[model samples]
Structures are given as C-alpha cells and as structure tokens.
Target chain A: MRLVQGNEAVVLGALAGGCNFYAGYPITPATEIMEQMARVLPARGGVFIQMEDELAALGAVIGAAWGGMRAMTATSGPGFSLMQEHIGYAAMTQTPCVIVDSQRVGPSTGQPTMPAQGDVMQARWGSHGDRPAIVVTASSVKDAYQMTQLSFEWADTYRLPVIVLLDAVLSHMRENVELPPAPPPFSRTLSPDVDVEKPFGNHPFVPFAETTRTIVTGLAHDETGATRGTVGHASEKIIRDAFNRLNHDYAAITQYREYRLEDAAWAVVSYGITARAARAAVDILRGEGMRVGLLELISLWPFPEPTVQSLARQVQGILMPELNLGQLILPLRAAVEGICPVAGLGRADGELFTPEEIANAMTSHSTHAERRVSHHA
Target chain B: MPKMGEDLHQYLRQQMMPTVWCPGCGHGNIARAIATALEHLGTDLGQVAILGGIGCSGRTPFYFNTNAMHTTHGRVLAFATGLKLANPRLTVITAMGDGDALAIGAGHFIHAARRNIDLTVILYNNSIYGMTGGQQAPTTPFNFRSTTSPFGNIEPTFDTVDLALAAGATYVARTTTFDFAEMPEYILGAIRHPGFAVVEILSQCPTYFGRLNKLGDPPDMLEYERNHTIVADEESVISRDELLGNLPVGVFRQEIRPEYTHQYADLCQARGGAYRA
Candidate 1:
C-alpha cells in the first residue's frame, strides 16, 4: 500500500514479477520506467543495461531471456515501432519476456512527451504475420502495477511475449495504489531434455532433424529446433500448435474488472487510461438511475472475448471510449456480431477523456438508446 | 611454432572440418586462422560460443563444434553482450564481414568498443560485398571496382583497426590472410585480451574483389597482400599519397580496460540494498 505514480507502479510490478534484467534506451514519457528499473533491479540482485539503441535493447532482452533470466525493455510509440521485428522474432521463438510501451502520438516522432493511445492496433498487429500475444493495459496507477505484474506472469506462463500497453496519461499520472506485499503468481518451465545427440526423435508434434533443445532463433523449426523450410505437415503443425496455445488456452490468460453490471442494458467496455474516465462516468450514470455497466478490461489481448461476447448478447449497446481512433471498438464490434450496436468515443488530441465528457455521452437521452434496448428485449 | 607442432590441415580436419564457407572463397583461410588461434590458446571447445552476424563470415559458427548462434544481420554484438553478461563464463566471440559490421551495424560496433564490452570481434575485411553480389561496401577501398562501383568507388574505405582504436577497443590488431602465422597470434591475443578486442583480418575475395579489380586469382591476391602490406611501427611514417597503396598489418594496440559488464556488476555491489531505500 503506497502512493505512487503510474510509472512507478509499472517499475514495481516489473520487479515483483521477477524481471531481473532490463535493457532499454530512453525515450520520453517512458524514461521513468527505465530510471526506476535501473534503481530497483540492482538492489534486487538484477541487471540493468542502457543499450545504444532500441534494436540493441530488444536484442539484449531476447538474449537475456534465452540465457534463463526474466528480462524486459521499455519504449514509447516510435521506439515501439522500431521493436516490431524483434517482437515478431520473440513471438516465433516463443521467448518469454515483457515489453512496456508508454505510447505517445506518432507517425514519425509526434508529441514525444504527450499522451495518446494511438498504438492500440499497432500493439496487436505490429509484427509480421499472425503471431498472437497477450496485451494488458493499465488505466490507473494501481492497474499499472497489477497489470504489469500480470504481463510478466502471462509471458512466462505461456512462453510468449507480453505487452504492457500504457499511454502517456496513465504512464505519467500520479495516484495512490495499494500493492500486494508479496510477489504475484508465476511459473517458469524448463525445456524437456531430448538429448542433443539424437536431436529429433520420433516425436509426434515436432519433426525429424530439428534440434533437441530450444534453438531460440527466429528461423522456422519443426518443434525440435532444427531449421525447416516452409513446407508440408511441419509448417501446418507449427502454425496450428502455436495458435492453439493462443486461442484455446487463451481464456486462462484473460483479466478484467466489471462494475455495476446487474440488470444493465448498456455497457462501456474500455481499457488503458480511458477506462478510468469510463469508470467515473459509469458511476455518475448509475447514480442517475441509468442501468449502465463498465467492463474495465485488464487484458487487452486474449481480449476478455468470452466475457465481452456474453455481455453484448444481454446488453442493448456497448459504448467503447479510447484515446485513439477507436482501435478496441472495432474488435468489440467484431466479437459482438451486431448483437449490440457499438458506439465509439475517441480523441487523439493528446488529451485524456474527462469524466464529465464520458458521463455526458452515457446519460444522454439519445433516442437510439431507447430503440436499442426495446429492440434487443 | 614448435609449441603448436601439429599440422594445421590435419588438426582442422580432426577438430573442425567440412568448412561452411562458400566454395572458391577466402573465408576458409579466415576460419583456419580462428581455429588455429583457439588451438594455440588451448581454449576448450565446449566453453566457447561463436556469435555470428548475417554475412559470409557469419557462417563461421556452423563449421565450429563450439556452442554458437547464427544471429540476425548486424546484431551479433548485441546478442554476444547479453550472453557474456548473463553467464560471464562463456568466451563470447562475434565474427562479421565488412558490410555486416560496418554498414548496417556501425552504431553497435562503435558503442560496443566505447563501452569496452567483454567479447572478441573478428572483422573479416574483403573490401566488397561477396554474399549479395559485389556491391560497394564501407570497406570497399576507394576507387575499387565492383558491381555497384563499376565506374570506380568515390567513398574512402574504413580502416577497421583504426576505427576500433578510436572507438576505445582495448585490443586492436590488423593482419592479412597472407600472414597466416602472425594472423593466428593476433587472433589469439585479441581473444585473451581484457576487453572489447578486435582483430580485423584482411581477407581475399577472389570471386568478387579479385575478379573486379583484376587482382588475378586467389594465389595472386594472397601474394599481393604479403608484398604490399607493411608491419606498423612507432617510427613508421607514410604520406597520404603513399597510404593509398599500402595497408598496414599487425598488432597495432593492446591495453587493459574495465569491461562494461564487470563495471555494471560493481555498480550493483556499491549501490547495495539502499538503492531502493
């Protein structure tokens, strides 16, 4: 239990989740994470390196992870863009690690120190191909701490890269947060020894000639870590198995918080910094006797899909507010299948949504709300 | 020479053979020098890891029986830095060609040397892009003929040893493939040196550099390297005009510097638990 800034919470969460090595090159709004980690990690018998650039930072984190250390790196929008290729490599290699993106506005080094959640879609599909990842967002300082802790756990649990998506608002905002005294839950698995000499045996999932140990390289492999070209059953199995871990066992990785949903006919599902505003707005609506619920998503990817779908079926509509041009709303609409009309409230003006602004939208006597509730019922 | 009395070819065949370099290339000689150096040092094969970048020289990891990685182009140093910091037990070595080390990875090369990272960089300089056609490279020597520089190169070449010394490499050495015996000693010394050792091997690329410049066959290129290169000395003086013809070769510098990882560990020790306190 402590009063801390959102950036401080993220740093504490990283330490609590057993991140022992941090390789980062400083970028604005994200510099606090690096500064805090530099101070905190060393005290906990960890390592911190300020790399020459974003590429080396990412490269070092990946190497450190392979060297059997829980590692991490932090960046903002521009630096995050620079890290996409290595992020893809981490996904393909199934390297367990975490990355924190304190997003700022950008196409090319846009507002360096200002807040914007413009990277919502980029976080999901930044890297090449269909590599699924676990993305969590922090709305407040407390969420920053808890969600970052969750990020590392999810990364290590599934042997995949986890992204802690923080916009400048939440990343720089200060608030009181009650952190759990003890460390959070996590599990790090060891590679099953398959005898390096025999390399690939008669394994069903992995193919022949692939190395026995985890190769940890970006090259395509047949599960045994041997480089295999894109062809045949090996390719199919690799893709299928990787996605199975993402889609099927994905439910176990989801984290979210629902507020005042009983008998609600409309919901505002949001993530990152905007969720704080959404929660405040939902409370005002609830006080005014409006049956509005807020689903504050903690896990941004493996996106509280089942819970969102269930709520969309029962609710008349969903209002998703974000800092970007409605990146999360598109996915919500896709999952809801028009069972509910999804309305988007987005502003990329480097300003956060005010509680008054969000409440006005929710409690408006819009005729569409009346028609939607009646039609759904 | 007597201490290492075994035949180089036989020793190579027994310990590391079936070379991974492309046929008709000079990388085999570079590989031979590296292997010979390790043999000279009595370095255990199990404890060494050859971290390689993407290039012709990057394939050096495949021929060696040591633990190694064929990392992405221009990123071997980053990976090697992590490996050395994590274990501090493995002898991490990076092998990269001219373009791989100097062009795409120039930033990393400079920083690695400046920080005095504990690793060895075996920079193979053949003065032309060999793997992806004979393109103009940072080390493609001024006015050298190549596919990209068909009319002749306008950019001046990088003297890798000089660049490394300027960038703070604790040990810096330059040797041509023609000086096989001395080349091995340079490699050995670079590997055993305290921090950020760089041994730039002036290699021959008969197919690319040789064919383009009409340096004749591989033997002629080797003979040219032997005759034209000078052993650098304290009193040695050459005019800028004379420098165009002669490339100095030999151990140019060696000094002990505290490595980045060790210094970082010491920082951790000094900060104590009061870091958070």
Candidate 2:
C-alpha cells in the first residue's frame, strides 16, 4: 500500500494490468503518464515509445496488441481526439486494450494545463460511429489506480478497448492513495483455442465468430476475418452479432461503489474528481439533517444504469455533479425514466467545484424538490 | 556479396514466376536488393517478414519467399511495427512507393521514423505513380512534366533522405538502380542498422514516368540516372537546388537510438512478464 498521484497511479495500474507496451506523444495533463512510463517501463522490462504524434502512438499500441501483447496509451483532449479513429478500429476488432484520457478544455487545443470535463461527450462519441466501450472514472488517486485496474479487466474480458477517463485535477494533483495488496484480477489474453480463428478461415468456431475475438479492424469482415461486403454476404447481422456479443455480456464487467444511500431523500451521482467534492458536500448536508447519499460511478460506459435506476426510485431527486457542462447528466436522467428530478451542476471555468458550491446546489435542489413532491402528494 | 545464382532465381520463381510488376520496372531491382541483403545476413528465412503497401513497390512481397503481407496502401509500417513487437526476433521490413509513403501515408511515415522503431523501410522512389498512371508524386522533381502536371510540376520535391533524417530515422540512405552494385550494400547495412532504417532507392518507372516526361525506354531511364546522379559526400550539406536535375545516391545518415519494442518489452518485464513494463 502506498500514496501516489493520479498520474502515477495510471502508470502503476497499467503496469500491474500487464500493459507492457506504451506508445504516446506527450500532451498537457497526460505528459506525466508518458514520462513515468518512459522512465519505469524500460527498467521494468516493458517498452515505452514517445511517438511523433497521437495517430502513430495509437497505431503502434494497436499493432503491439495484435502481436499478442497487452498495450496502452495516454493523452489529453487534443491527443485523445486524434486517437478516436484508431479507437474505433480497436472497438470494432475487439482488441483488448486501455486508453487513459486526462481531459482538458478543448474544441481544438483549448487550455493545456487546466482541467475540464469537455471530453465526456467526445469520449463517448469521439470515434466515427456507434462503437461501445467500458469506461471507468476515478475520483481520487486510489480510485484512479483501482478504476484503471478494473478498466483493464473489463477491456480484456470483453475483448474491446476500455477508457480510464481522468481530468486535469486528478491527473496532476498529488495524493496519498493506498496501493492494492497485489494487483487483483490478472489481465486476460487470447486462449490457445484462438489459433483456430484465422483471418481467412473458411469455417470458424461460432462462439468466437460472433465476438470478433480474432479480427480487430473496421473492414467488413466474415468469421475468418476476411473482408467481404458483396451483396450475398452483406449482412448487417454480422455487425449486430459482433456488437451484440459485446453488449450481451457487459453486466459481469460493470462495477461501482455506493455510499450512505440506504434511507436518503436525495442522491448525488458523481465521478472522477467532482465525486470527491460531492462526497464532501454530502457529509456537510448530512450534518444539516438532510438525507443525502453519494453514488460514485466507477464505470461510466456500459453505465451502472440498473443501480442508478433503483436508487432513483427511492430518492425524490438526483443531482449529477461534474466538472464540465454536465455530459453524463442526460444518461442518468434517461436511465431513471424521469421518475425523479435530475439536475446537472457543472463548471467549465477550469476550477474544481468547491464543497460549498456542491452543498448549496444539493441543499437547495433537495429543499425545492421536497416541497414540490409534498404538494403533489 | 554472394554471387546471384540459381538459388535466388528459385526463391523468386517460388513466389509465382510471371510477377505482377510490369516488364523492365525498377521494383524488380528493389526486390533483388532486399533478397540479396537478407541472404547476406544468413538469417533464418522463416524469421523474416516483408510487409508491403499498395503500389508497384507493394508487389515485391509476392515475389519475396518469406512471411510477407500485402497490406493496404500506406499502412505497411503500422503493420510491420506490430509484427516486430510481437516477436522482436523477426526481421520486419516494409516496402512502399512515393504516393503510398508520401501522400496518403505521410502521417504514418513521419511518425514511424520519429519513434525509431526497429524496422527497416525500403522506399522505392520512382518519381511518378506508375500503377495509377503517371500522376505527380511527392518525390517528383519540380518543373518535370507528368500526366497530372502537363505543363510541368510546380511543387517542390520532398527529398527522401532529408525527410527521413529530419523525422529522426536512425539510418537514412539513398541508392539507385543505376548503382546496382551498391544497392545490396545499402540494403544490408540498413537491415543490420539497430534502429529505424530507411533506404530510398531511386527506381525507374520506365512505363509511366518515361512516356510522360519523354525519357523514352527503360535503358534510357537507367542511362539518365547514371548521367544525372552524384554520389553524396558524408560531411557535406547541400540544398535541393544544388541537387536539382541530379539525384545524390549514397548512404545519407546512420545513427542509433532505443527501439520502441525494446522499451515496450522492458515495460512488460517490469510488470512481471518476460520484458519490463
């Protein structure tokens, strides 16, 4: 067990998760992840490459993973934006890997050093099409480590890319996070049975066929991984089958942690650094005789919707505390079916949400919702 | 160098005799140089993989008797990088032409060199696009007429050696089919170079580039190369204008840098695998 910054935690978590190859181009907030990997990966018997740009960095990682190695890359908004195309390729091919995006302000190269949650939507939709991911967010250094470790597990288990969504605040800020005893849940790899799954196999095993466990690219591919989109075999079922297999077994990989929600009238759902501030506010509100609970989202994509829905049923309203203009609020609202009042509290001014700010939002919103619910009752 | 004999011909024939490349094309010369280099190294043929991108140069993989992949245009380096990292023991080589490497694949080429990946890139620079007809290429000399540039090209040529060197390629060299005797030496040296190595071969596209530019026949193109090119000096630095109408063919730069795969493996080992992470 040890204390570490969120940046160091990502590197350590990647190492523990069996990511032996890291290729990246240094960018703000994400530079430390590359720096640490460059310094330690070589000494530890892994390879760290500082590529010329984000495209090659992602390409190299994709190639390394193809060669049967667990690989990863780190970047900020600009770099992550460049990596979307390759990320789409990874998702379509079911290549098990991890990408850490320590987000910052950006439409095109916004503030480099400042923290922003602007990439929440981009992370979900940055790639060209509807490619799903197993995304995890971290509120603290320890959460960064734990969530990243979980991200690798989900990535390997589902055979797709997993994103560890961090922000500038968590990426650069120093913290004392106790390290795990031994990196839990060793990363998975292709089984020897995968040998039967060839790119041009005339007959492929049906189980792995639908999963695309072997073929990892965007080209229209058959079970053997050969590209064939002609009329006879131009079945959309192939795409649906591949994605369905991925979507079919997502629940086993989803994870989250709930805090003080047993008999609460209001719920605060937060992730990454904002969750820390929300928790502080929750404590202050509890002292003020308000039943406020904290629901820290460990996994963002393949979102823990079932839990959020059940919790929303118990609460009169839910407040999504975030660092940007509230990207995850819509998902939370849609999942709960408008049963509870959902409010998005965010800031894009590159400042952490102070506890007082969250307390005011939570306290004020809960009070307003209580009066409305009582009048309707 | 070992005498080019019956065994080399047998290796070539095994990849299917009537090769896809046009008759008298310089890609054959480039393929010969690569085979000679590999043969000189006495490497286990199975441990070497030649990855190729689409173009006249891409077909070199079909005639090379090794683990070869005919990948999409301008993507050879990306796939080759993967193959190298997978085993690191496998000698990975990539072959591509001007448009393949310079135009659409420019991003990949520059980035591959910058990483100093332990892969050898054999760029066959034939000035014009032969497979797609004589369109202008990145290496097409300024004021040279082509199918696309009927009134002579206006854009400056991208010096292959200069681009590689600037992009941090550990080994950069320029050779030509006109200097066939030296081609094997450059190829072998590049293969043995410890880091990212790029060998730019000034190849002859007698079919398209010749007809469009009125260079006449295959032998005529070779004669032009022999007449125009100068052997570059190691210590000298010259501008593009100085080399205008004259290709400088020689070893350009050779340096050493840590390979991407090595550092990647080191990270793996640190993470408790065979290599450090």
Candidate 3:
C-alpha cells in the first residue's frame, strides 16, 4: 500500500485500464491528471496531448476512440460544460470514451480549488437530448483508483461515454491505497471481415469492425450510420435500444453500499465526499441507540431507484446531505414517490459537512416525523 | 443500369443522393475536385477518413464512401487531429467552411497548423455563412454586404493562405471553384504533403453572397473570380493589398518540418516499449 493523491490514482488507474490516448487541457484540481499523463503516457507508449480547450479535448478523445484507442480527458466544472456538445456527439455515435470531471464550486468558474457537488445533476443532463448517462462517483482515494478503472471498463463494454465524477476534495486529498494487479486491457470486440455495403449493422448495439469503412455522424442515423433525415422509425428505434440496453441491466449498472440498515427507521442518503461524513454519522447514531443507517451511492446516474424504493419501505424518513443545494434529493424524492418523507441538508459555501451536522439533521428528521405522525393520528 | 462514370461509385455513398446544396453553390465543384484528387492519388478508401464541420462544406463527408465523421460546428480539425495521431496510417482530411474555419474554429485551425500534424484541411471559403443564411464571415471581403452587414462590411477579410502560412503550416495553397482545371492538382498536392497542409478553395454561395452583392448568377460570379485571380509564382512581386482584391491563387508555402505523430513515434521507439506499431 502506498499513499497517493486521488488525481494520481486516476492516472495509475487509467494506465492499468489500458488507456492509450489522453487529450486534455489543464484545469484546477484536475491538472495533476493531465500532468501525470504527460509525464508517463508517452514512456508507456500511449499518447498524451494537451489540447487547446475542453471542447477540443473531448473532441479529440472521441476521435481517438473511433481510431480504436481507449481514450480519456480530465477537467473541472467549466471545462466539463465546454465538452457537453461533443459528449452528446459521442453518445449519438456510440463511441466509448471516459471523461473525468473533477468538480469545483461553480455556476461558472466558482471557487476552482474548493469542492462542490453542484454538478451532480449537470453530469446527467449537461448534454442536450435524452441520452443514457453512466456516471460513477468516488468518495475516497482508493475508490478513485478503482472507479477510474471501472469507468474505462464500463465505457468499453457499453460503447458510451462514462463520467467519473470527482470533487475537489476527493481529487486533492491523499490517502493510502493498495494498487490492484493490472487487469487485461478491455477492447471493443470487432468482426474480422468487413461488409463494405453495410459497414454498421442494423443495430447500433452491434459493434462494427475496424476493418470496415464506416461513417459515424451526429445526425439522426440508421443502423448503418447513414443520415436519415425525416426518415422512418430507424433513428427512434436506435436511440430507444441504446437506453433500453442500460435500463435492462440495472442490476449490473446500479452500484451502492448500505451501512447498518438491519432495522433502521431513518437513513442518510449521500454520495462523494458527503458519504464519508454520512458513514461516520451513521456509526455515531447507532452508538446513541438511534436507528439511523447510511445508503452511500457510488453510481450517481441511472440512479439506484429500485434500491431507494426498497429502502423507503423499510425507513420512515431519508435525509440527503449533499455539498450542493438539494441536487440528489430530486431523484431521491422521485424514487421514494410519497412512500416516505425525504429532506435535504445542503451546504454550497464550499465547506464539507461534518459528522455532527449530518447526525443533527437525522435527529431533527426523526423528531419531525414523530410530530407529524402524532398530528396525523 | 449504371451511369458512365460508375467507377466513381466506389468513392460515394449513393443512397444519400440529392445533395442539399443550392443549384449554383460552388461547394459541389469543390466536392468534385476533392473526389477527383482522391481518385488521382488512388488512396485506399478503407484507410481514409473525412471529417467535416457544420456547414454546406461540412456535408461533404456524408457523400464519401470512406470512414467519415460529421462532427460539431467548427471542431472537425480537433477531431481529425486525434484520429491522425491515434492511427497515423489513416489518411485524415477535414472539410470546413469560412465561418467554420476562420470565425468559430480559428483557434483550432491555428493550433493544428502550429503542431504540424499530418492531415489535410480543405477550407471552403464562400465569404459568408451560407448555412445560417449568409451572415458576414471572416473571409467576407471588405465593403461587401451580408445579412449581418446590410449596409457594408466594415471589417477586413482574412486571407486564409496567409493565415495558414503564419500558423506554420508546411503546405499552403489557394484555389477557387472557378479554377476547376487546377483545383484537383492543388488538392492532390496538399494531400501528398507530409505535414499540416491547407488548401483554401474560394467557393461561391450564389444564393447568399451573390444575391447580397448583386453579383448576377453563379456563372457570373465564377467569371468574376477567374478574372480577379493572379497565378502566384516564386518571383511574384504583388503586394498584400493588391493580392486581397485580386487574389493570388497558387501554393504560397511548402517547407520540410518535423511532423507531430512521426516525432511521437520516434519518442516511443527511443523509450523502448510496446507502443510502436
């Protein structure tokens, strides 16, 4: 086990995951990822390019992915916003690539060095159009390494852009992490022969052979990657299939950890750095004989709705403590769907929530639940 | 039941016929020139990739039979750069318009030239944003009227050849849709060059630029362009101002410089790992 920063772990994770091309522009809190890539990727026979801006960074990553390389780019909030257009393009073209957005406080260039989970919703809905998003969050340095590797695997497996959302604190914080043995590089399965007339098959899910001459466009296209302007239902069918593929595999896609929920009456739902405090709060509340548990989310998008539904049945109330003002609570409340009461304890002033603050919110939620039950009775 | 030049079918996507270009638009001529250049060079269709931006010129990739990527507005060069670096064997080319290249995509154009990566850029200079109804573009001549400049354009125009040369492109050339005889030769030369090569084709947006400037019809515009151009030679002593209105149409720069991807390969070789292919 060696101590390393979360950004450094991301670099090691990307290399171990077989990332061969990294195109990025340096941004606060995410610059280390780019710097490490520049220092090491070339020596390892990979390509590391500092692009002109975030738009070009993601653009190049999509291009590299089409060139049959496992490519990635790292940036902060402002940069992530610049990449939304190409992110939509990557989704439409079904190019597998990883984008690591190390979160900083911002609507636009807000505290670059400070941590904020304001981009949680943006990660899912930043790009225009209704596209499937696979976003995973890491709360600790070890999780950063593991999740970064898993992000590449998921991107390659699903043929979509997977976001590894890291906040400023988790990105800069250092912790001891045991680096796992490098897994065999995961590559897209391609056919050996080429059908020149139909390079891409009838299904967008079906992987096209690199040997085949194919056209990949952002326009509404049929299975063969031909633009079908106001054509039949081919475009709609392909987009539906893309979303259905992920939705059907919810068991594999949804990832979360439940703590001390054997017979809990209330729970604290959180992710990223806030989960760290929520876990501590859960343990403290348990010591005080309060039935409070923690549901820590690792997979933020395609949100574990089923899991939340089940938890809502078991718990009377859920308190969501986030760094932003009630971003995660929207989905959490929707998942609960009036089955249970959900409250948010948010802080967007760039300070992380303390264990005591989360515990206090849980206590107040329990009191409010009791008062409401009595009044209803 | 095929046409006379059925062999050209190998390079085209026949299904996406009835191109959206206006009847007199010069983009068709530029596209034909590119097709003829590829045919002349005999490049492997499977190993070639055409990337295009959002404009009339951007749609050129959709007609090609090779691997094509119709990308975002003004960002095809960034994408092409990555593709070329990742697979140096692929012949990558980008098709963009004046507004796409000089206005929004100017940063990428300059940076790509500075890097000297091996790729070809075909800038279709229509002098107006034809895709968006002919707004004044960076290449629109001074005192010309566009939708945005109804009275007259106050800003000076950009000479793409000079821009490419200043950005350190190893090969820079200028041609026009009117110069149909020489367009393919210039495109072929640009494609054959090792480093970043740009061939700026002064195309006409007859529906927009022609109408706004009262330049008669497509034929009239072509005739005017032909008469205004001077064939640039090594000993040419024409001043920049003179060349602006009466354009100099020929290769302006060709130099031997270290290419980005090739140098990267050499670095990988020196480092002694499994990166070399």
Candidate 4:
C-alpha cells in the first residue's frame, strides 16, 4: 500500500498487468502516465515511446500488440479524438491494446486542467462503424489502480481495445492506494493446433505475431485474418462474432458496485469522480433516513443494463449526477424504461458535484416522483 | 502451372491471385521488384513483415507470404515502427502510395526518418491517388490534371527523394518502374541498409495519371521516364529543380547512423535492465 495519484496508479497497474510496450504523446493529465512509463518501463525490459502524435501512439500500440506484446497509450481529450480512427482499426483488427483517455472538458480543447465526464459517449461511440467497445471508468486512486490492471485483462481476453476513461479530477487527485501483488504476466493463449502457415486457426482471442504470419487488416477478415470485404456472409459473420464474443461474456465484462441499494427507494447513479460525491451523498441521505443509495458504474459501456433494470424495479427514482450534461442518464433512462423516473444532475463548468448538491437532487427527485404519483391517483 | 517466375511461388500467396491492380499499372512492377529483391537477398520469408498503407500500393502486402498488415490509410510506417521496435529481428518493409506516404502520412514519414529506424520504405510514387479514382496526390507533377485538379494543378509537387534525404533517411534512392532490371537492386540495397532507407519507385498510373495527362500508354510513360531522367554522378552537382523535373534516378544519399531499436536496447542494457531479445 502506497499513496499515489490516479495517473501514477495507472502506471503501477499497467506494470502489474504485464504491459511491456507503451507508446504515447504527452498531453496534460495523461503526460504523467507517459513520463512514468518512460522512467520505469525500460528498466522492466519494456518499451516506452513518445510518439509524434496520438494517432501514432495508438497506431504503434496496435502494431506492438500484433508483435506479441501487451501495449497501451495514454492521452487526453484532443489527443483521444485524434486516436479515434486507429481505435476503429484496432477494433476492426481485433487488436488487444489499452487506451487510457484522461478526459478533460472538450468538444475541442475546452478546459484542459479541469475535470469533466465529457468523453463518456465518445468512449462508447467515438470510433466510426458498428463495433464492440469495452470502456471502464475509475472513480478514485484505488479504482484507477485496479481498473487499469483489469482493462488489460479485458483487452487481452476479448482481443479488442479497452478504454480506461479517467476524468481530470481523479487523474490528478492523490490518495492512499493499496497495490495488489503483481500477477504473472498475461499473454494471449495460442492454440496448440494452430498451423504456422495459417495462424488464427478458429480462435478469436489469438493475437497476431511474426511466427503466426497472420495478416492483420482493418478490412473485415475471417478467423484466418484474410480480408473478406462484403463478399459473402464472412464479413458479416466476423463482425457479429466480434460482438458476440463480448456479449457472451457479459457477466465477466460488466462490473459495478451497489452502495446501500438494499431497501432503498431513491438511487444516485454516477461514475468516475462524480461517483465519489454520489457515495458521500448516499451516506448523507441515509443519515437523514431518506433511504437513498448509490449505483456506482465501473464499466461505462455494455451500460450495465441488466443491473440498472433490476435497480429500476427496486427504486422509485434515480438521480444521475455527472460532470457532463447528462450523458449516462440517457442510457439509464432506456434501461429503466419508465418503470422508475430517472433525473440527471449534470454540471460541465469544471466543478465536481458536492455531497450536499447530490443529496438535494435526490430529495427533489423523490419529492417530484411522489407528487406525480399522487396527482395520477 | 504458374507464369514465368513460377520458382518465386514460395514468396507469394498463391491463393491471393488476380491482384487488384489495373492492367499496365506500375504497382505490379514495384511489387515484382520487391519479390525479386527478397529473393536476391535470400531473406527468410518467415522473418519478414510487409506492411502497407491504404491505396493501390497498400494491397502489396496481401500478395506476399510473410507476416503482413494492410494498415489504415497513411499510417503503415507508424505501425511498422512499433512492430520493429517490439521485435527488432523482423525485417520490416512498408509499401505506400504517393498520397499515402506524403499527404496524410507525411508527418510519420519525416519522423520515422529522423528516428533512423531500420525499415525499408518502398514508396510507389504514381503521382495520383490511383485507388480513389484519379485524385491529385502530393507527388502529382505541377500542372498535371486529375479528377480533383480537372483544370491544371496550381500546387507545386514534392520531390520525395529530396524530402527523404532532408528528413535524415540514411539511404535514399529513386528508380522508375521502367528500370525493372535495376529496381530490385535498389530495393535490395534499401533492405540491407542498417538505418532508415527509402526507395521511391516512379510508378506509372496509366489508368489515371497517364490518360488525364495524355501521356499515352504504359510504354509511353516508361519512354518519358527514360528520356527525361538523368543519373546523378559524383562529378556533377544536380540542382533541385533539374532533379525534380528530370526525375534523377539513383542512390542520392547513404549514411551510417545509430539505428533506433539497437540504441534503445543498448540504453536498457547500460541501465542494468534486461534488454528484450
């Protein structure tokens, strides 16, 4: 156990997760991740590269992954936007790599120094085309440490780019984080029956390598890694299979925590730094005997629909407090499907929501719900 | 039964026959030159990785039997950089079209040269975006007409060989597809060079650059290259303008520099860290 910043925790977590190659361009809130990697990765016999831009950073990470190395890149909003094209490529090629997006306020480089959950939607759908995205958000230094390690495992297991979305506040904030004992370095399992001449034999998780002679391309390819562009059902089958691989393992991929949800009527749904305040708000509301609980989302994509649906049946209303203007609430509403009313308490002025604010929102939301029910009756 | 180079079947993926290049496209010649160069060098096919950017030239990697990756448009070199750095033993060769190499991917081109990474860049300079239906490319000759430049092009063209040399490519050479016999030797030289090597092949795009510019058939373009190009010698100093116009063909620069991967490994070892083999 040691005190560490969120960005520092990411570095420690990545090392523990067996990341051997890191390529990145220095951007604020994420530069420390690159700097730390540069200082430590080489000593650990790993490769650390400061690429010319974020495009090259992700591009290199994809190539390193194919070259039989666990690789990653870190960048903030503008840099993250630049990486979207290759992120699609990584997704298409089924490349196992981690992309750490320490998000700041942006449509374009809006506050770089302040915290915002602006990239939640971007992390899910920033890349073009229909593709499966595995995005996880971290709320504290501990979650940052553990989630970064889990991000690699998810990426390797699924053979796709896994995004660790960290907001500016959590990224810069420091706290005492207990680092777990490092696990054995994880490598993608190659099939024993894989033909050297034609690798990628029937296994979806197999990574490309020099020995494999596998041709990794952005064009839709079959299990053998050959380009099959809309020719038959092959392209469609491959894309569907890529999605199915994640969908089939939804139980393992979806991660979240319920704080005081049992016997609660109102819930605050939040993620990243906003979740920190939500947790506190849950405590404050519970102290007042308001029966308010919190649903802290750890996995942002695959949306934790089942859990949200179940929670919807238990709660009268849900208040989603986020740093951005109600991105996660939209999906939460769909998941709840009007069984329970969902309200968004969003702020994008580079300020985090306080416990008092969240507690007030929860009170107001439940009051409105009660009034609406009485009026209908 | 295969065609004339049936013996070279070992280097090619026989199943991926009937390539996407148009008839008389110089990309085929460039691809053949690559195959010949690897054969000449007796390079272990398994130890080679052919990377290609998106374009007509980007499809080159699919024909090869080695570890290949047809990457996104204008990003093959970036991918190759990572692959080479991760496993320095693999001989990395990148193929990119004129626009792929110089237009969108120009930043990577210059930076890769500056880093002096050991990769052979086979730039197929066709002067037009052949794959995307005859758009003007970075290497499109001044006043050359294309789909985008239907009127005469007002933009000045890039002398890629000069650009490569200026950007610190340790080995820089230019050859036309017409010089088929000599093209392989230049490619072989690039492959053998220990630092960043660029072999720009002046490939003719008969379907696009040729027809739009009224340069006749593929043979006519080849004739134009033969007539206009002058081989630079030690005795004469060729001006940039003349070199650009006449397409000065030959090895323009060669230097020894510390290769990036080797230096990185040495740095790690010097720091008492185990260098990744």
Pick the DockQ winner.
4
| lDDT of model number 1 | 0.77
lDDT of 4 by residue, A109-209 (tens): 89999989999999889999887889999988989888899998888777789999998888888997678765554455667666665333225454455
lDDT of 1 by residue, A247-270 (tens): 877667777888888888888888
TM-score of each: 0.89, 0.78, 0.96, 0.96
Model 3: lDDT of residue A276: 98
In model 3, what is the error at residue B33, expressed in angstroms?
Answer: 1.0
Pairs that collide in candidate 4 are none
Model 4: residues >4 Å from true position, as ranges? A181-191, A195-204, A207-211, A228-232, B1-6, B233-244
Over the stretch B1-277, how does candidate 4's per-residue lDDT look in tens digits?
Answer: 1123436778888777879999999988888888888887777787899999999999999999998999999998889999888888889999998899999999999999999999999999989999989999988878889999999899999888889989999999988988877788888889999999999999999999999999999999999878778887344688887766576888888889999998899878876667654
The Cα error of candidate 3 at residue A270, in Å, is 0.4
DockQ-superior candidate, 2 or 4: 4
lDDT of 2 by residue, B149-172 (tens): 999999998887888889999988
Candidate 2 lands at a TM-score of: 0.78
Weakest ten-residue segment in model 1 chain A by summed lDDT:
A201-210
lDDT of 3 by residue, B1-277 (tens): 1112325667787777778899999998888888888887787887789899998999999888778889999999999988887788888889999999998999999999999999999999999999889899998888999999999999998889889999999999998999887788878888889999999988888999999999999999999889889877455787787766588888888788999998888887787634543
Going through the candidates in order, what is the number of backbone clashes in each? 2, 38, 0, 0
The runs of at least 3 residues in candidate 1 whose Cα sits more than 4 Å from the true structure, single-residue gaps closed, are A180-216, A228-236, A363-366, A369-377, B1-20, B233-244, B273-277
lDDT of 2 by residue, A1-377 (tens): 55577899888888677777787888998899999887776554555666667876776676666555678899999899888877877765556778999988766788888888778777778887666667777878877887777676666666678888898889988886667543432323435555444532222222222223232335555554544345226324454554566567767656676788889889899887888888888899999998989998877877778889999989989998887887899789889876789888988878889888998998888878889978989
CAPRI tier of model 4: medium
Error of 3 at B120 (Å): 0.3
**Winner of 1 and 4 under TM-score:** 4
The alpha-carbon lDDT assigned to residue A23 of candidate 4 equals: 98
